[model samples]
Target: MPDAQLRPEPFIQQTAPAALEDLRARLRATRWPDTPEDAGWSLGTDLDYLRELVTYWAEDFDWPAQEARLARLPRFRVPLGGLGIHFVHARATAPTTPALPLVLSHGWPDSFWRYSKVVPLLTDPGAHGGDPADAFDVVVPDMPGYGYSDRPAGPPLDSVAVAGLWAELMTVLGYERFGAAGGDVGSHVSRYLGLDHPDRVVAVHRTDGGLPVFTGDPADLTQEERSWIDGAAAWGAVEGAYAAIHRTKPQTAAFGLTDSPAGLAAWIVEKLRSWSDSDGDIERSFTKDEILTNITLYWLTGTIGSSMRMYRANAAIPPAQHARRVEVPSGFSLFPGEPVLPPRAWLERTTNMVRLTEPARGGHFAAFEEPEAYAQELRDFFRPYRTGTAAD
Candidate 1:
C-alpha cells in the first residue's frame, strides 16, 4: 500500500456485455457510404472491411475474456486535485536488482493498454533475458478522462498539468524522482515533464523526436529540415483531416463519436492502422479484441468528448507557448513510420537532446508495436542515469 495521504484505489469493473450490446446496436444502425470500384484505401476506410470488423466485434469478439485478462493486473486509482486518476502499478518479483521508478504515459486513442506487453519486459527484464539492473518499477497511468480516470471539472487536460499530476503520483508512491517516456501526444507530455519538472524527472525519452510547428522559413531549414517539411506537408495532405477537425470543432465531432460505438472505432482504428508499425493493417499486429478494448475504454468512460478537447485546447495555446524549448536531457527514438518525423537539428532546438537513435522498425505506437526494441531503447538510455536519481 502507498501512503494513506494518497486517495485509496477507485476500481471500476469493465462491463463486457454492455460494450458488446452497444457495438451491436451501433452496427445495426450504421449509415453506409457509397463507393465505386477500385476506390480502395485511397478513400479513407473501406466501408466493406469496416462492416466486417464491426460484425466480428459485435458477434464473435470475447470482451469478457479480455476484461478478465486485464483484471489480473494490479490496478488502482488516486485522487489528484479532485480527480481520480487510474493507473497500473506492477512491481518486479526480482530480488537481486534494484527497480528504478519509471512512468509511462499513453497518447490519444491509446489507453494504458499500450504498455501491457512492455510492462513485464521493463519491470522484469531478467525474465526476458535482459539485464536485471535495467528493470523498472513501472507505473502506467491512464491520462485524465482517458481511462478509469474521471473527467476534470476545472481546466482542460493540458500537457503541463498532466505532467504535474504525474510528478505528484510518483511522490505519493514514495519516489522523489523518476524517469518518463511517451509517444505522439504522450511524447509532448513527457517533454513537458522534463521541461517543467526537471528536478523530479531523471531523464525523458520520446519516439516522435519533437515535431516543430512549421513557420514557412525555408532559409532557416537545412536539407534534412526541408525534406522533413516536405514529408509532413504530404502527410498532412493525405491524413491530417482528423487534426483539422479536432482543432476546429471537437464538440461537434464528439457528438457522433461519443454516441456511436462504430463511429468511435473507425475514428480511432484509422489512426492505429495508419500510424502503427503493423504494415498498414491493424489486424496484422493487434487482435480485434485489442483494438476494441481501447475504443471501448473511451466509450464506456464517456471521455471521447474530453479526449478530443485536448486538440482544441492545445490549439488555443499560442504557437510560442507550444514551441518552448526543453532544457532537460532528452532522448529520441525516431520510429520509421510516424506522421511528422523530425531531423536531429530540428529537434535539438526544442529539446536538450542527449541521445538520438533511428530504429529500423516500429511506428507511433512503438511500445506496443515493437516491444523488444522499445524496451531496449528505454533500458540503454536510462541505465546510466538510474543511480543517484531520486527515482531509485
Candidate 2:
C-alpha cells in the first residue's frame, strides 16, 4: 500500500460548458491564411485540410463523448517532487502469473493520450488475444507541463529532472523496480531512467536511440552508423524548425498557438500527418476526433508554452551527459514510418541493447498508431525481466 501522504486522488474530466463554447467560437472565427495555388503540405500544414478540420471542430466534433471515453481510464493525481503529477494506473487483470510493473512515458505534441490505446492491451492481455501471463500493471504519467500535470513554476524541468520525478512517483505508487518504455521526449526520459536508476529500472525500451550525438572519433562509428547520423542531420534541417522554435523562442510561438485553436491544430496536425504512417493522409491513422482530442487537451490546459519550454531546458543538458551510455538492458523498435531510424550499431554503442526490431508499420506515435503491435513489443522485450509479481 502507498503511504497516506502519497495516496493518489481520483481525477475526473470536466471542462466547463463555457470553455467548450469559447473554443468553438474561436475555431469558427479563425482568420484564414493564404497560400500559393495547389500548395499541398510542401510549405507547412495544408490550408484546405486545416479549414475542413476547423469547420468540423467548430460545428460537428463532440467533446462530451470524448471526455466520457477518457473518463473510462483509471486516472489519478498525486503530488511528487513538488509537482502534482497526473497519471493512469491500471492493474493487471486476472494474471495467470505474476505481472510486471511498466511505466509508459509520452513525448512532445502529445501527453498520456499517446498511450491510451495500449493501456488496455498491456494491462489485460488475455482479453486482447494475448496470454494472461503477459499482463502488466501499467502506469502512464503525463510529464509535468503536459496534460493535467502542473507546470513547473520556475525553470522548465528537463528529461533528467523528469526522470527523477518519475523515480519518486513510482516509489509513491509502490513500485520499487519497474520496466520503462517511451518514444520521442519520453525516450529521453526513459534513457535517463536507465542511466540514472539502473538498480530500479528492470529494463528500458525505446522507439529510437535518440538523436545521434557522437562526440568521439567519427571513424569509431560503423558505416551504417555514419550514414544514419547524416540522415538525421538532413532530416532535422527540413522538419526540425518547430523544435528550434520550441527550444529558442517558445514564448513567441506560444502566444499564437495558445490563443488560436486553428493555429494549435495546424501546429500539431502537421506532425501527426508527417510523422505517422498515414502516407500524407492523417485521417488514415487517426480520426478527426482523435486529432482534436490531443490538440484540445493542450488548448484547454493552456500548456503549449510550458510544454515547449522543456526544449529549452533540455538544450542546456551538458554534452557529457549525452555522451554517457546507458548500461541497463535496453530494446529498440524502429517503426518504418518514423523519419529518422537509428541503426543497430548506433543503439549498441549507446546502450546495452538486448533486442532491436523493425516493425512493419507505425511512426513516431506508435503506441497510438499501432497499439497492439506496440503492446506486443513491450510484452516480448520485458518478458525475460519479469522476475516477480506486480506486488514484488
Write model 1 residue lDDT over 1-392, tens digit each, in one string.
24568865746576866666766787788887788887766677766777887888777877778778787677898898788898998876572556778889888887788887898898888888898888888889988878788787765777777888888888788787788999877887898888888887888998986455765467877888888878878878778888888778878988998888778887888888888778767787678888888777787788987877777666765676666787878899988867678888888867888999988888888888789999999998998778754333
Candidate 2 at residue 49, lDDT?
94
Clashes of 1: 0
lDDT of 2 at 242: 96
* Model 1: colliding residue pairs: none
* lDDT for each residue of candidate 2 in 299-318, tens digit (9 for 90 to 100): 99999999999999999999
**Candidate 2 TM-score versus the reference:** 0.98
Model 1 reaches what TM-score against the true structure? 0.93
Segments of candidate 2 deviating more than 4 angstroms? 1-3
**Which candidate has the highest TM-score of all?**
2
List per-prediction Cα lDDT, in the order shown. 0.80, 0.92
* lDDT value, residue 56 of candidate 2: 93
Worst 10 residues of 2 by lDDT: 383-392
TM-scores for all candidates: the values are 0.93, 0.98
